[model samples]
Target chain A: MRRRSVVVVGAGPAGLAAADTALAAGADVTLVDSAERPGGQYHRMLPDAYGARAPEAVQHGYRSFERRVRRVLDHPRCSWWAGAEVWALERRDPGGAAPAAPAPSCPPPKVHVLAPAPGGGPRRRHVLEPDALVLATGAHDRVLPFPGWDLPGVCTAGAAQALAKGERVVVGDRVVVAGTGPFLLPVAVSLLEAGSTVVEVVEAGARARVARGWLGRPWELGAQAGKAGELLALTGVLARHRVPYRFGRAVVAARGDGRVEEVVTAAVRADWSVVPGTERAAAVDVVCVGHGFTPRLELPVAAGCALRPGPRGTSEVYVDVDDDQATSSPGVYACGEITGVAGAPAARTEGALAGWLAAGGAPRAGAVRALRRRRDQGRAFARRLAHAHPVGAAWPGWLRPDTVVCRCEETDYATVCAAAQDPTATEARAAKLATRAGLGPCQGRVCGPTIAELRHRHGTGQPPAGPTDPGSHHRPLAQPIRLGELARPPAPPAPDRPDLAHLPPEESGS
Target chain B: MSPRLVPARDDSVRRTDHPLTVTVDGEPVPGIAGQTLAGVLLAAGRTAWRTAGSGAPRGVFCGIGVCFDCLVTVNGERDVRACTRRAHDGDAVTTQSRRSGDPGDARAGERP
Candidate 1:
């Protein structure tokens, strides 16, 4: 029997696990990631040139991750494509016009990749049609707009942490890390470790609400003891650094001349409505803010995967998957934060299950049962997380009319509000067209959800559902491709070979 | 205040002393291997490399390439993300501006 071929679109924990287990199940695997390394944002490995003696000191579960990296990348059946971006996924027509024998009823989408050429030449594009596809593209920080967020020195907490972890570079000499989740703690620790003087870590969730959200259910957290311990250790580091961790407070505005010189912090109620007379100012070179995470949904949506509403009471949406980790679209599977913002452990378990199933592993395998239970626990934890650090419905109150909502288009709150409130612009699509908020370079990856929510809040009525919905989050071109690259024909698919040796010189490298 | 690199002795993450220079706007800026273009610029105390349509100075916002605010022209290639691209020796980096009348407008030549 021929070996099943699997293409995992992300080299993160979930994608790595998918490749590892698929290879173990005797399937040929091709693992691809945009970064130069195997680890996604979670395991963001420092460049080998750093030659760090204690890389593990800055990472969690580093030893296990290292083992997985070797096991998958070194496996003969696994082809690793680093610094490759999946520009598009071309869905095969479901209609049986051109009959291709042995193709699954729901054929996997054709993968279009832009792989970097060896030795810094122009990137070459390749196309692949695998038997099964696994998506683990992961998520990015979702920052709410504020008065001076577009200032030079303000950045997302994830960006600050990425600089510290991946490059040993701190974002600033003096910084304020403000957000609404446990993720804020680690960002502060990373900043401090990278030699930044973290003046304060401000969390928007009220102390009582946050505690109730976490302590409301004790038994459910038994599987997450490791997570709790990690948070506790992070808090200890903050205490040792003498960094003040303030609850019920948020950085509502940033002020500076050319760059951020000060941040205005204000106390907020449980719903994040600012309390009158509670505003305070602190001088800082940089301010890092993160509300939560927004999943990289372009690939999954491009693959035509169905999305279900995210955790209770949130407008977020995640890929809908079955018990076997199969997406609604056949031959497609989704894991990691794209399914939900469950942490790495859950993503890994989901990946293993998806990989095994995609490789045609037995449905009733003993390992499959264990993986499902862990995935369920992860989902439960995701629910608790959302309950605890919910983005306050009143967060829009933080926005001033002049605040820039869309960084790329430089669309401000007043313009967005005007578009939303205009009687003629009843549809979210109309508002987007009017303001050009999500049409900029980012393609709404940063402001889609926020704009959708703002429209639903300020508009005359709820925007009609479907792709036209501002939050639909659909884009035909998943990644940016230059006109020249797009005009060129994709490399022809190799015949019956899953090995990278068949690929062009640029992508043939392991 | 400028961002600085964490010293090897302080963090136990020893970086190779492989020195490299990338010219920025005709001036040579020094950096080490494994550091991104954004990292070098931040460490060199030069933030706000790009400007918005309103002429507001911008720098790294979302450093992982999701946000295009950190874009710079590299080696004459337009709109390369500074946060994700590793700086190479002799790489020519030019700061970009989106102000309507500025020649640096990324879309200026493409349209009317």
Candidate 2:
């Protein structure tokens, strides 16, 4: 019997684990990512081409993370296509089957990749048809737009950390790292090490809330107990650097003439609503803000997977998965953050399950049982974290009519509100069309969540900001390759695969 | 102008390469390899790239390719994302005006 072929999108912990486990189980695996490097956002390191001399000592966090990724990249049965952008997903259905599928029913979907350069050369697109598809596409920062967020000196905390790690650079001199979650700690430490005068780390979530939730849940943390060690170390680093750490406070607004010069830090209640009496101005050149993460579900949603309402209170979109990590779509599996934003350990376990299933393996029952228990614990902890730092919808209070919400099209709060309140506009997509909020170069990456929430508030009277479908509605060219790349002459169909009817047309020769 | 903030360059890690000059909004800016065009601009303390309808300037919001707030015209190619596009020596970078139309019909001119 021929070995099953698996295409894993993303090189983060989940995707890496999926590829490696599936390959180890005797399946051919191809790992794909947008960055030049393999590790997803969490374990991201500088590419080898950068030629870092002392690799381990340079980056913060565990080097073991990279070692885990190395296991995947080193596997003989796995091949990695770096710097590739997945623009579309084409499913070939069996004849007279689902109306969407153009061709006869083919079990797996064809992954379309735009390679800026395949072999240190010209850009080209390649098609990969797999026996099974594993989407480990990770998460990106959930931007809650505040006044002056679009200013030059302001960026997301994740972006700040990535810049320091990838380019060894910090944004500005006096930096204020503010947001919810402990993710800010390492980013602050790294910036401090990079000679930035960290004014303070502002956390919106009250410290009492975290202790109340996590103090008793010690057993669930398990192997991640080292998180406490890292936390203690980060606290020491901040204190030694003379950086003040403030809790129950958030950077409500950033101000500057041309770039960020100061941020208005205000104390907040448990739900993160700002307290009126505590507003104070702090002079800082760079304001790094992050609320939390939202999963990158474009590929999964594009593959026609079903989304169930995420954890009880959170407004997150979760790809419904069973014990085996299989999605509603046949032969399609999702793992890691795409399943839900659990930490790396949970992601790895989910990936293992997905890989095992995709590789056509009947895993040992005991091992499967153990993986499910770990996933449950990780998910539970994630829910508690989400509950603590939930995105307070009251942020619209910070916006004036002119404050820009959609940076791509320059749509402001007033415009989006007008569209949302328009009696004709019932759904979020209508607001999107009227205001052109999500229709720019970004296709709504900046304004999608905020717009959807505002629409939900005005149109439906729904509250929380957690569970909105931030994914772009089924557009074929989601990534937006240049038209010049697509206008090439149609290539001849391969003799072995002459029926290329299911795929979109592209020029065979330039 | 005030003196620029000094970065922590003394760490164990070495930069990918040396700095070279790239023109940002017609001014010569020093940029290094492995840094994006936006990184170079942000390093120089210039953030607002283009003035939009509201008259407030837009800079890097998402910092990744998605946001496109860090967009600038590089060598006459409009709608280029400065966050993902690396800076090269003598690369001419200019502010992207939101109202300006793209110079092409770029899809024309066939053979690569």
Candidate 3:
């Protein structure tokens, strides 16, 4: 095996495993994370808490992941940088694309990172130079607006779970977890396990089946069904506690004063539209809602990597290495939710394949045929989970005109639509007069789709949809650098461009 | 219960109590104090915002300002991100299909 140095950003599932695989394959590895330890958002750890609080299936997976994280941390050849946040990344040669072949052994691509000490004082900046880069910056929950969505008690399901898991704090005793997709079940179970009263799981998907849902021809369906049964059994604890699980329903409004006091539930149609007569109101203290997750591609996009739309509504990076996992960006590889939300077990297998490929250990030539079959079987199985529940078109019915849609600026649907149409011509000259979207702190992550959908209703073309151009980000400061930070200089402007500089290094040699 | 879509003119703010008026898509409509343009329009029963290129029904999704689904030209400015801005009296609103070019049209906070 050949030896090389690689940098893996994010200490999550893919990041830690990639480093371990690279090190085992004889490459020196540097692992960096914005947190004090590994275990990204999904396997969040409590500050004063101990062990995993999830059910047996998740705990078993967590143990394996934790074991790997520990092993990688202990590796002699591995360098770990905790509490490091990467602000940007620019090519050494600047512009264009990642190199097709390895460069002459001079200095590898440098990674600039910002690390704030644990006790909390001044933040320190550090750089890591490596031959290859692996980005696994995980994902965040997708929040849709509702009447009381902005209320103090209303947070994304992920945020609520994080608070409960990481801080040993619960949002409220009575919580209604609403929305669609497999994530809801796990989040609901987690909340229930934490002793919260889960009044109802308002899923947009119906309980009735369209057809006899088959596992598939090859027959791993039995195992998946078993897993689903186990999760159902755990969630059943809600019933024993007399908690209600309302299928084919969604939360239309969450009404309260400073916090959530009541939630209105509506029966949904096939397209996930709210039925006229099925609206029902129930009192509740806390409401956790999320549609799904958009795979985070900020780091990858910042690096100028190409992305394509995934089966899920979000965009994902395009990888050339078949099912084994390798990205089109040379030497760079990724897996897990970073590529797509394929769950833990699928991620484990994909990560293993990526590690093997990254180390120059190609599988047997003929094995491709069999590998393809296995991958197909697994992907087919994964699809069942993917389509189990989806945030439907009717989700917007919950939003009252005054409900704040964009959290950054507190813009609501009324203001946004007014600006889009320019009724009085006051906002007539706003940028991109046509679509009238893409305005806000997040650019358009929260409201772009809604804008496009509305446009469609008005007989306008679809909103120009695609991943936001990540490469357009140009910032002088990497992090929230204070005035004092600028005063100190680690070194007087070296000839080389700083790590993550959008410009190519000034000093380059053939 | 389905989420309640509050009427623009609530019982507390009936026309007899305090009648208000606002312009939507160039037409004058009855409005109420403290009501948003969206609430006013929904109460008036106008479904379309900006026409999709193919002309489809697009409305609010992710009600929070994040979705950007309710964008329109409230005044002369072309690309006003609707979700973030508030509607004022006499404000002009027009349907938008797509950005028409000038990166810096107006709406300083609006991103191209």
Candidate 4:
């Protein structure tokens, strides 16, 4: 009998748990991550990543995740791939585009992986045929524009956390962790434990208000508050470790000689503009700022899975997966942050449920479905957290004229702003001409929303949301593929001007 | 329990003695020795990295290299994520600007 295989993307908590479930159920499992290590960013393990006195919460989280990862790795039926990025997916079809398989039915899917081996020479591609596919692809931080934000020392709350947690190095003796949502809390706690004197936590939302709302939603309040309490207790750090918590305040400007030394912050009004007299300046060595996170949806988007507006402004795949963690796309399932940023426990539950359902085993009648409902409930809470902490419109106040917007292309706000102000340009052409925002390797996946928001403010008017039809934006090769791989044999010769010609050369050939 | 993840209790992590001069928004500044461009800028107390609307300040948030928040221009390259790239002696780092119109078309032919 042919061995059944399941591929789980992302080695974070959810993916690992799913792989474990599959392995226990006697299914062959493969777990993959872009990093050299498992645990994703949240459970990142550093080689001397953090100090010996690192917060117990972080230590505990990683300890638990590590044990689970090890358990999965030790399983005879389970295989693991670190530093492997899944670049594309191929199904046997004419368009080569994998049709969105209908929900809950596990299809034998093929995943294309790019691994630039440890020595770092050329990256190689490998394909895996899995009877079931699970996306635990996790998320990236939300980008907010602020003046001097283009300068050095300015980073995301997640980045700061990583340095403190994984590298065990503090950004500076004096640091500020500023952003919205629960994401910033761990960062603050980590920095404090790392011996960095947290100058302040410049939060855009009023914590009091969020706390009030969170309390009303007892479940959410408990989940987040518990996490926060754990981190604070483990770090043995106090609120003073974080400078006074300035709620509803946004960083307006961060200026220094060549680095960040001082930051200007202000309270944001309803119109998303800074309120006068609320502006204040704080002297600091590093400023870590972010709004929130957008789900990493490249695979799903490329898979042609229909998307609905996520809790945040991002898009998420629509699935009928009846609590069993299945996607409307048959044979494919999603859990964890990919299902929306519902945190770790929910992701683990969803993954286990999916594994159980995928393995010839039904979810003990209503039990499996009930677990799925619990996952959904957790997701709903996550959505609210995302909503409340959504990168508020007022974050733009932090951008300076010289601040960089697009790092991949080196495009900045001034150039992008000029293009948005161009009265005659169409939205499509304007984005291309100005700022070089969408022109980067990412193709504007990270900066698209921010660009659109900037354009609207600059009178570009609102461009319609939803996938751009008739536009060559969407095509088969979504992730970065090797140039040589694309030009391989049997892949057609050059078509000078094709509908999907706009795709990057690396992505186009595939 | 991985040894690589433990931080040395000593704060005396000696940085290489290499100085670089970079400008942030026309202000000539000195970068610290043996630090990433992002670190030098942060040590110097500059926080904003890029702006999206009305030229605001944005900075590094996810330092582990996942979030693309800490992006900036190093020399002539656009989108040179500040957090990952190391700063060198005499390196010129500048804050990015929000471009208008076709963002890529302006520098389309330029080498990355």
> How many clashes in each candidate?
0, 14, 93, 107
Give the least accurate 10-residue stretch of model 3 chain A, judged by summed lDDT. Answer: A491-500
Worst 10 residues of 4 chain A by lDDT: A491-500
- Judge the docking of candidate 3 as incorrect, acceptable, medium or high: incorrect
Question: Chain A TM-score for each candidate, in the given order?
Answer: 0.94, 0.90, 0.80, 0.83
> Tens digits of per-residue lDDT for model 4 on A294-412?
56666755544444556544333232244567665566777777667656676777777776666545567576667666666677667666665655555566566777676655577
Candidates by DockQ, descending order: 1, 2, 4, 3
Which of the predicted structures, 1 or 4, would earn the higher DockQ when compared with the native? 1
Q: What range of 10 consecutive residues in model 1 chain A has the weakest lDDT sum?
A: A95-104
Query: A228-256 in candidate 1: lDDT tens per residue?
Result: 66787888999999999999999899999
Q: Which numbered prediction scores highest in lDDT against the true structure?
A: 1
Model 4 bad stretches (over 4 Å) = A48-58, A91-109, A116-121, A219-236, A240-242, A312-322, A365-370, A394-403, A410-430, A433-435, A456-463, A467-481, A484-510, B1-7, B10-62, B66-112
Error of 2 at A85 (Å): 0.5
Can you write out model 2's per-residue Cα lDDT over B29-101, one digit (the tens) per residue?
A: 8876656777777777666676554455777766667677677889877778887777778989988555434
True contacts kept of each: 0.79, 0.49, 0.04, 0.29
Give the CA lDDT, 0 to 100, for residue A387 in model 3: 55
The segments of candidate 3 whose C-alpha lies over 4 angstroms from its true place after superposition are A48-60, A93-109, A117-120, A209-230, A312-324, A363-378, A421-510, B1-112
True-structure RMSD, every candidate: 3.2, 4.7, 14.4, 8.6
Interface RMSD of each: 1.2, 3.2, 17.9, 9.4
